[model samples]
Target: MNPLKRLASQTAVYGVSSVLGRFLNYLLVPFLTYTFAPAEYGVVAEFYAYMGFLAVLLAFGLETGYFRFRAGGEWRPETVYGTVFSFLVLVNALCFLAFLLWSQPLAALLRHAEHPEYIGWCAAILALDSIGALAFARLRAEERAGYFATIKLIEIGANVGLTIFFIYVARQAHEADPGSLLGRLWDPDIGIGYVFIANLAASALKLLLLTPQFVSGLGAFDTGLFKRLIRYSLPMVVIGMAGIVNEMLDRAALKYLLPHDDATNMAQLGIYSACYKLSILMSLFIQAFRYAGEPFFFSYAKRHDAGRTYAVVLNWFVLCCVFLFLLVTLYIDVFQYFVGADYRSGLDVVPVLLLANLLLGVYVNLSIWYKLTDRTLMGAGVSLIGSAITIGLLFWWVPVHGYMGAAWAHLVCYGTMVVLSYALGRRYYPVPYDVWRVLGHIAFGIGLYLASRWLVTEQGWHWLVAGTVCMAAFLVVVGWEAWRLRRGASAIPGV
Candidate 1:
């Protein structure tokens, strides 16, 4: 099979898991929005934002480091895995211990001082997830895409099931009487605390499921391997921090930046979070693409005309993202039902955020230039630039405009990073990415989407048909370009 075809197949298999997991997780939006007040949902959002930052710290960028060293072919696979795995175990242990020691102050700082258990439980979840990172990375490296997808879907399924049982069933049990199963296990007043518990349960289950990866083909721990992996992975920690900050600083800053009190801040954030979930379709593609693309890029970089090959792949990546963006935005009136009625107000942010996500997906695809060139510091620089832009905008705009400010902040931040990476990639590892053609596709897709929206209702099956046609038109243009490239390649036959 052609390399691209193989990648596409793997992406689809992985995407099955990704798309389904995201869809299942998306179900939580309506459930949470309907069950919890907006303020309560905001609490969920903030806690998850904290979880996001903690994941970066606990994993310590080892995922990217695994790809980097494993690609370099300098160490035994077992040796590298053992070293990194052991290090993560130590860090996770230390993280939990620190959280135990500081949960009081941390809760106070987070303004949930009475809910230190939230911090403690979340700390445990982060630790388990961090320790399990290598096992998942190994699955990716081994091309076990099916297993990877299965594990993800299983986790999502478990989380969703547990959440429903806890919130809907357990809450009712507690409400009717104190002497009940849910009342015994949970405090009825702790509205959003159950969300963390559900996640912890899910993470623990995922860890248990991945136990076979830990036990199989074990190797003795190596100190030399540890030092090397740390050396390579440490810069990525900085990059990961900046990257997470870029992605999350707006959400994190919103409470502080907004003029509203705690209740209103959360109310605004709840709306933002719920609407943001609608873009998970694009996020699913980006994630599945990353899982398949990282190794694909490393392998492709070894090809003689790797730069041209990368350019070709980049075009396809951008086209898919742009097409998905149009599809989501054009039929957003239908998609908004994914969240409950309370969140419908934030639908306006979807197009802005969807475009931002497209830029982010493009940036991820473009990042191989720095990775392959061993200029990973450029990644740190790129993330810092993006973070600065996002933070600046949040402080300046969010206070006045609320969620709309955040939407624009995401666009500005991701767009800056994408353009900067491309400009620098040209200087360091030039790839002939068809910049004009890619932008033209984006412009054309947007135009077709607008025309479709003007022609059809925003809800019902008719909306789906119109959005599908809009996306199909964009794909048709890309297919024509691909055919022309194929014909040109065919004509260059050797005598």
Candidate 2:
């Protein structure tokens, strides 16, 4: 099979789990928003942002490291898996222990001193999630996308189901009859904490389902292989942590930087984070591609035409992203229903955040340079640059313009990172990436969206009609571009 097609097949399988699973999980946003006020939901948002940071730390970047060495076929797969998973088990255990021990102090620091269980529960959730990442990575390395997707969907399905039961079913039952058997599961004071409880249960169930892989990996541990993996993976930790800083720091910072009372600030944070769900489709696509793309990059790195393949892969990746961008932005009037009316206030950030995520996906493609070359230290350096910009902008912007500033901060950070990665990539490992054409795809996508907006607002065209017409035009443009690329022509050649 063509390599790109094979990768897409893998991505589609991963996407089935990631997109479908996260979409199912995302369905909770509206429910939660309606059930809890913005300030209440804000705590959920902040804790998840912290989870993003700790998750990268706990995984220790072994997912990519596992892929790199395993694809090289030098070491036994069992040995590689054992070395990575065993160490993760140790790391996550310690993390969960620390969170349990110092949950109060951490909760106090996070301004949630009243409910330290928030700290403990989120920590447990991240620990399980971090451990599951390597097991999932094992599936990818073995090309078990079907199994991977099945487990992911089952886990997410359980999470969504349990969440509803705890927050809705149990709550309603308790309200009707406090002495009912299921009523004990519903506690008014616990409120949004039930979401974390559901997540923790689901994560544990996922780990249980992967017990065969875990048990298989735990005993074959090799000291020498562990050293090799650590050496390669440590820099990945830095890169991953720094990447999380760029993607999530805004949420962590917004509450402090908003220059308002705690309640007002949290309300603002809740709205921003909830509206963030609108951009989840783009983020989910980037995530699914990462799950598939990283392995594909490493496995194909030694090919003579690898650069061309990377370029082609990126072109298609950006095309899909721009398509998603238009899909959401063009029909945002409809997509706004994904979040409750409370979150619709921050809807302006949706397009900005989507475009930022598109830029982030581009950076992900460019970042392959460092990973393939084993220059992850340099990759970390690039990410640190983005981290710095993100911090400075959050401090500088959020105090002034509020959540829109946070949105722009994401745009600027990713845009700079993309440029830096492309420059550094050309010097370290040049790829014939048609980045200009990729930008053209983005620019053209934006233009089509604008024209559609104009059609509805100025020309008085029906929105559905305008959206359909423009979407069809964008598809025709992409079709033309693909045909030209296939013909080895930048422009139409002689018939």
Candidate 3:
């Protein structure tokens, strides 16, 4: 099989799980948005941002390290897994212990004084997910795409089902009649905290399902390999954490930076976060690509035409993201039905976010150079540069423009990272990426979206008709490019 085709196949399998999971989780969006006010959902959003930040810490970059060292083939797979797994357990255990000891202070500090259980649940979810990260990474390393997809689907399915049960079945029932059996099980005091509880349950269930990997690595720990893994992977922690800073700092800053009172600010965040879900498709595809791309980049790095292959992969990636961008922006009204009317006010930010996610996906692809060349420190540097932009602009803009400012912060931050990563990628491990073509696709997508909006708003065309015309035009352009690229294709198996 063609290597690009093989990577695509792996990415498709990963996408099945990720895209489907996002779709399933989207069910929760309507459910939560319709049921609770934006202020309520904002709490869930903030806690998740916190979880993302902490998860980067707990994983300690070991997944990438495992892929790196394990690719050397000097260590047995079991021993490598054992080394990573044992280290994760130690890290997660200590972190969870700290959460348990001071969850009260932590909750109070975060202004959730009455619900320290939220902090504890968040900590546990982070721990379980960090370990599960390695288990899934192992599956990717072994090319166990079927197993990987299956477990992801199962975990997401469990989460969706439990959320429906807790929020729809029990809570609603209790609201109507508080003296019943299901009502007795429901706790109004917990309120939106059920979101955390459902996640905790889902994480626990997922860890339980991954018991095979957890149990298999128990006897093979190697102190020497472990230390080396730490040294190599620690920079990745900086990379990962800095990446989170670029990604989540906007949300974090929004809470404190907004000039409104807490409820109003939280309400604004809830609206922003809900609309952020509109970019879920773009983000999910990027995630699926990362899952497959990481191992593929490492394993294929030494091949003669590897650089061309990587370049072509980025081309396809940009086109896919462009299509998604147009798909969402051109037909945003249809997508708006996914959230409640109250949340609709912030839908304007979705296009900005979708474009930002496209740039983030590009950076994800460009990151291959750094990871492949063991220049992760440089990667961290690039990410911190983006983080600084994110912080500065977020502070400057969020208070004035509110959530739109955050949306622009994301766009600027990711756009800068893509440029920096590409520049650094050239200096370190040069790939012949089709830079002009990639930029053209993005420009074309955005232009089409703007044209479609004009048709709908200015010329008074029906939105559905305008969206259809715009989408068809974009598809025609993409198809032509695809055919032309194939006709001129000269990226053979070897130099």
lDDT of 2 by residue, 399-471 (tens): 9999999999999999999999999999999998887898899999999989998999999999999999999
Evaluate model 3: give its TM-score.
Answer: 0.98
Model 3, residue 331: C-alpha shift (Å): 0.6
Candidate 3 per-residue C-alpha lDDT over 1-495 given as tens digits, one digit per residue, 9 for 90 to 100:
677778989999999889998799889999999999999999999999998899999999999999998898888888999999988889899999999999999989988899999988999999999999999998999999999989888888888898889888898789899998888768989888888888888889888988897777676999999888988899999999988988887776678999999989999999999999999999999999999999999999988888878888888899999999988888888999999999999998999999999999999999998888888888889988888899999999999999999999999999999999899888889999989989999999989999998998899999999999999998898899887665544445631
- The Cα error of candidate 3 at residue 326, in Å, is 0.4
Q: What is the lDDT of residue 195 in candidate 2?
A: 94
Q: Which regions in candidate 3 have their CA more than 4 angstroms from the true location?
A: 488-491
Residue 155 C-alpha lDDT in model 1: 92
Per-candidate local distance difference test = 0.82, 0.90, 0.90
TM-score of every candidate relative to the true structure: 0.93, 0.96, 0.98
Worst 10 residues of 1 by lDDT: 486-495
Clashes of each: 0, 0, 0
TM-score of 2: 0.96
Question: Which residue window of length 10 is worst by lDDT in model 3?
Answer: 486-495
Task: Give RMSD (Å) of candidate 2 vs. truth.
Answer: 2.6
